[model samples]
Target chain A: MIQFDQVTKRYSGGVEALKNLSFSIDSGEMVFLAGHSGAGKSTLLKLISGLERATSGSVMVSGHNLSKLRGSQLPFVRQHIGVVFQDHKILFDRNVFDNVMLPLDIIGFDRREAARRVRAALDKVGLLGKEKVMPIRLSGGEQQRLCIARAVVHRPAILIADEPSANLDRAYALDIMELFKSFHQVGVTVLISAHDETLMEDYGRRILRLKEGQFTA
Target chain B: MKHYLFLHWQSARTALAKILRQPVGSLLSLAMLSIAMALPLSLYLTVMSIQDWVGKLTQTPQITLFMEQSAETADIAAVSSALKTHPRVKGYTFISKKQALTDLEKRNGLNGLTEGLDGNPLPDAFVVTPASLEPKQLELLQKELSGLPMVEEAQFDASWAKRLYGMVDLGKHLTVFLALALSVALVLITHNTIRMQILARRDEIEVSKLIGATDSFIRRPFLYHALWQGLLAGLVAWGLTAWLIAVANPAIAEFAQLYNERVELRGLSPLELALVLGCAVLLATLGARLAADHHLRRVSAN
Candidate 1:
């Protein structure tokens, strides 16, 4: 479960990115964040992922408050929450399989176990047969799927992504959403932010709309 | 513990693989480090060998005590007794006037000259070798021996002994300063190398951080990379030092032969070579840790 109470994120130059926002989502729930550009969608997801500290108030993920967490403790929190970056954050220097194996390697998984998990993750994202292919040869939608595979390889408890469907065609974007839906079905808490209202509404999931860093009615 | 060791080995292999993939760059780095290391190491070895040669050359300083013509055997025995009881005197040899005359007659150039002499003009002498070569102590011992019964004069050749000691002291101090300065240079070089590596792999590192990797997790391979670099540099420096000594040994031997002496420059021993490798690895790893931690902290802060 994740909870945010009176959260306000003010950057160094004094631009308020999040303003007194408060919300809670139960475990195993799929939630959508819908807002236009500069609507604090990325900032909100970053807070949930432990990538940024809230200037004021509290962010609670899995019963631990993020603001009060120590620097060393932050990684442990991140290990449980997998994040698919907005720009796809895929390493092009290696094959698709090695890219996904990075997370398991971080956790120090043994070779046999890591290989199994990597193949499983690749299978989930339909990249199992393309294991040896470098990321440059991957199409944009396939690359997006590769990012998803890498994010979920460690079997994180919470999976979050920001603007995952932005650059994709309607068909490919819908396919990517279905993949997140599959992870959410297995009792993984899923949170996604997208500006496409019609696309997000099709899932019939709860949507939190933000306007100028604050939620709208 | 088993898993930990396996992960460490894995990191080491990955680090080595990266270096092997870039042979030219890795060799360039190794060349820079080994040459820097060899400079002080070679100087240190040369200084030690020179001191060793100097010690052998002037191992004993003998003060000669020439006796008066009228001194009898009793006077010589008294001088011998005093030298035996003296704490500063290592040992002494006696030469009666008759024995001195016979030795002079047997000499290569002075054989005929001694035949023209009358009544063995050479004086009886005692050659006293002191245990301590300290100039003040030698002068004091010479003065005391000269004041003894029937002793005409006492003196020792101290200039050569004094100059050798001074040179040895200077060489030792010079090597110390050189070693300290070179160690710092090696560390900074390792730091810059690791910094470039971190910057080149920024994408991989950032992604590692984004998905649950600890700062240490990301730094392990880089530290291992530095460890390999340090180890190779140390080993190469040892080889280079040995090769240099081999090249210089003939010249050193020829010089020694000119003085009817034989001195061989000793290269680093196995234990000393091990020490160099260990130090190189330690400093390189330390540099890597600083470089990696600094970059990681900055990335996490933003």
Candidate 2:
């Protein structure tokens, strides 16, 4: 579960990235964060992920207040929330399996168990056959899929994807959306940030719209 | 705690693998660090060897005594007899005034001038050798000898001894100063290298942090990279020092031979080698930490 109670984030340069924004999502629910560029979508996600502190109000993920969480506790909160980026974020030096295994590795998963989960996650993303392949050798669609597999590899309770379909083709983008739909069907909460109205129309999920640092849904 | 350590090791291993992917850069950094560390370490070893040699050479039985020209044979015999009875006095040679003049004439080629002199001008002297030439005991013996009735002056051949001791003191201070300067330079170089690595991998690092990688998780690989760099550099430094000693050994031996001595150059003992390794590890870890902390903070802040 994620909750934001009138959160505001002001930068030192006098720019307000988020202003008194308030929102909440129930467990196992999939939601879309719709906004134009600089509409505070990224800021909202960052606050939810405990990556940034709210300037004035409170943001809580899984009952841990983001503003009150100490530096040492941020990692524990992060291990429960899977995040994906538009750019795939795969470590180019490692193979597909290793990249997917990263989150598990960070959490100190058992070696044999980590290997099994990594294989299962790759299989889920339709990347099982390409486990040993380097990320650079994969196609753009495959790389993005690998990124998805990496995000879900740890079986996180909630998944956050910031512009997950930004750079992919229509077909690839649709495939990614379907992957998120599958994850949501399996009782995993999902939140995605996107400006593609066409894609949103196809998915038919609840959309939270933002304009000029204020949520307007 | 076991879990933390295992994760740390895994992180370090992953980092090392990544570094191995770029062998050229890693080797270059290692070589540079090794050379930087080797110079001062070699100097330190050389100073230690020289100190040991001086300690050995100064432990010889040698003393000097001056006498008055007015001293009679009876007074001279009395002084010699008294020195002979002392427990520490190993041997004493009485150099009579006539014998001193004859030795001087032989050295200066003035035999005819010495024959024309009415009487022997040189005073009686005692060349005393003590049983033990240990510094403290020798000083005590010199004091006792100087207190004798007929002896004009009692001195030790400690001029060269003083010079050797002074050099040891100077070497110690110089080693400390040089090690400090070199260590600072080493840290800076490693910091710059790590900073460059962070900048090159900026996107990866940012994404890692965004995706819930802890600072320590992100920092682990950089720390490992530093540790490896330090270890490799330490190995190279050790090799460099060994090579330098090999080349300089003959020259040092020649100098020692001229002084009628058999001095050997010493290498790093096991403890010293461990110290060198430890130093390298420390510098690399510090450098990595600085670079990682600085860049990670910047990335997380943004």
Candidate 3:
């Protein structure tokens, strides 16, 4: 569960990224965050993941208040939330298996069991045979899928992706959406931020629209 | 618990891999650190060896009180009584001129040479043993005895001993200062090395942090890498020091032959070697820990 009660986040130098925004999402719900380039979607998601704190109002994830959470407690808050960035933050130095196994490794899964889960996550993303392959060798869509596999590898309760399908073609974008749908169908709460309304409309989920740091709907 | 162990083991394994991945860089770092370590260590070895050599020689400092050749038996008695009551003199043995002449005749071939002499040229003397072996203390005792009436001269053959003691003192101070400076330099070297590794892996570390990795988890591999580097450097320094001692041993033995003294060039003891290696590892670990904590906090702030 996520809640933002009239939260306002202002950057240094008088830049208000999000102003007095209030929203809440229940458990087991898939919500689409529809917004333009500077609509504060990424900022909202960051606040929910405890990466950034609210300036004035309270932001709560589960029962813990994000504003009151100290730096030491952030990791525990983050372990249960999976986040995919727009830039596809994949490690090119290591092979695909190690990349996907990162979250499980963070959570300290056994080596054999972590390898098993990594394979399953990779298989789900349709990159099963490319386990030993380096991330640099993967195509754009494969790399984004690799990011997705990493996010969901630990079975986080809430999955948040920030424009995950940003540079993909229509087909790959649809496949990425379908992957989110599959995870949601398994009762995992999912929130995705995207500019493409049509693609999100195809999934027929609840859409939360934002325009210029304020919720439009 | 099992998972925790596995994570540590995995970090250690990755640390080895990272070091092996860049063999030239790792080897160069090891060489620099070993030389840094060996400079101070070699100095320490030299000081200890000198100490060992000096320790083998007779160091009981004695002061000789020579009586005036014109003095009679009363003068000898005066000087002898003064030496007996002196607090600094632990004991004194008097050698009369007749006894000195007799001892001279007992030498290798000086029997007839001393017999033909008109009178005994040797003065009556007292070989006075001081209570302390310290050069300054013995000098004070000699000075005190030299001012005695009817005393021709008060002598202590400790000039070479004084010089040796001074050199040993200087060596000790130099060794400590050099060790401290090199230890600090080694810490900085390790810190910079780990800082560069962190910079190179900035993306990797950022991603790891985003994926819920704790700071300790992220720092584990870098710490292990520093540890391995320090351990390798220690080993190299030990080997180099041993080789140096080996090369100098024969020369030292030959030099000692001139003095009819057998000197052995021994390297560091087991305890000292352990101390050197332990210091290396501890310094490296401290540097890596500091660097990792600093850089990771900056990365996570974003």
Candidate 4:
């Protein structure tokens, strides 16, 4: 579950990204945050991820007030959540399997168990046989899928993806949306931020649209 | 607990793999650290060897008491007996003024310089060997002997020992200064290397942070990389010092032979070698930690 009670995030030099915005999402609820380029979608996700604190009010994730969370507590808070960035931050220095193994490795899952889970996660994202292949050799959609595999490898309770299909084609974008839906079907609470309004029409899930840092509907 | 051990083992294995992947870069970093460590270690060992050789002289220090020229024969005999009865005196050989002149005349070119003098210019003296070879105790003996009646001056004539002491003191101070400077150099070198590594892997680190990686988890591989670099560099420095001593030993032995002095060339002792290796690892670890902290914080802040 995530809650933002009158949250305000203002960067330095008086740039207020989010101003007194309030929202809440219950457990097992898959919702999409829709906003334009300069909207506060990424800022909202960062606040929930403990990467950035709300400038004024509280942002709570899984019953913990993130503003009050100390630096030492951030890692523990983050362990229950998985985040996917827009840039598809897959490490090319190693193979695809190692990239997907990052989350499980961070959480100290047993090797055999981690390998099994990694393969399972990869299989879910349709990258099962590309384990040993370098990430740079993967196509754009495959790379995005690899990021999804890495995010879900540890089976986090809450998954937040920022622009997961930002630069991909319509088919690739739909594929990524379908991957999020699959995780959502398994009772994983998902929050995906995207600017495209038409993509969410067929999902039939709740959409929280923000226009200039305030919910439009 | 088993999972924890497995995680550490995996991190260590990954660290080694990362190092092996960049063979040239890793080797270059190790060589730089090794040369930095070896230069100071070589100087320190050289100074220690010099101190060791000086320590082996084994001759007890001597004090010479020169009697006043106008002193009477009875006063001279009294001083001689006093020197003989002193507890610290191992032996005393009296040198009369005539014997002193005779010995001076036996030099390379001044055979008859004192032949036509009206009287013997040299005073009666006694070369008294102290039972203690310690410079402090010998100095104390010289002070006590100078207080005796009819003794003009009592002094130590071990000028070579004094010169050696001065040089050794200077060498010791220089070694300390050099050690401090080079240790800082080593830390900075390691810091720069780790900084570069962090910068190169900035994206990976950010992704790891996003995926719930703790700071320690993110830092493990870099720390191990630093540790490996330190260990390899320590070994290289050890080898370099040994090689330097080996290359210089024959010449040193030949020089010592000309002086009819027994000298043995020695490298670092076991304890000292351990110290060098341990300090190398420690400095490098500290450097790596500092760099990692700075860069990781920067990445997380972004």
TM-score of each: 0.90, 0.84, 0.87, 0.85
Name the candidate, 1 or 4, with the larger lDDT value: 1
B24-136 per-residue lDDT for model 1 (tens digits): 99999999988889988999898888888778766677888999999988888888899999999999898888888778667534666656767678899888889888878
The residue-by-residue lDDT of candidate 1 on A118-211, one tens digit each, is: 9999999999999999999999999999999988999988999989999999999999999999999999999999998899988999999999
Can you tell me the DockQ of model 1? 0.69
lDDT of the candidates, in the order given = 0.89, 0.86, 0.89, 0.88
Per-residue alpha-carbon lDDT of candidate 4 for residues B1-302, written as tens digits (9 for 90 to 100): 78678877888788888888999999899899999998889888888888887766536567889999998899988998888889988999999998988888875357777767887889999999898877788888989999999899997877577789789889999999999999999899999999999999998898888777889999988888888788789989999999999998899899898887766668988998899989998999899999999988998735
Model 3 CA lDDT for position B10: 87
* Chain A TM value for model 1: 0.99
lDDT of each residue in A1-217, candidate 4, tens digit only: 8999999999999889898988899999999999998898998888998988888999989999999988878988888888888887788899999998888888888778999999999999999999999998999889989988988899999999999878888888998899899999999999999999789888999999987777887
Q: Could you give candidate 3's per-residue lDDT for residues B114-212 as a string of tens digits?
A: 657787898989999988877678878888899988899998866676678779889999999999999999899999999999999999889888877
Assess the local accuracy of residue B234 in candidate 3 as a C-alpha lDDT between 0 and 100.
95
Q: Pick the candidate with the highest DockQ.
A: 1
lDDT of 2 by residue, A1-217 (tens): 8988989999889899998988899999999999898998888888887877899998889988878989778878888988887556678877998899778877789999999999999999899999999999999889888988989999999999989998888988988899999999999999999987789877778899999999785
Worst 10 residues of 2 chain B by lDDT: B203-212
Query: Given candidate 2, what's the lDDT at residue B118?
Result: 80
Ranking by DockQ: 1, 3, 4, 2
Looking at model 1, the pairs that clash are: none
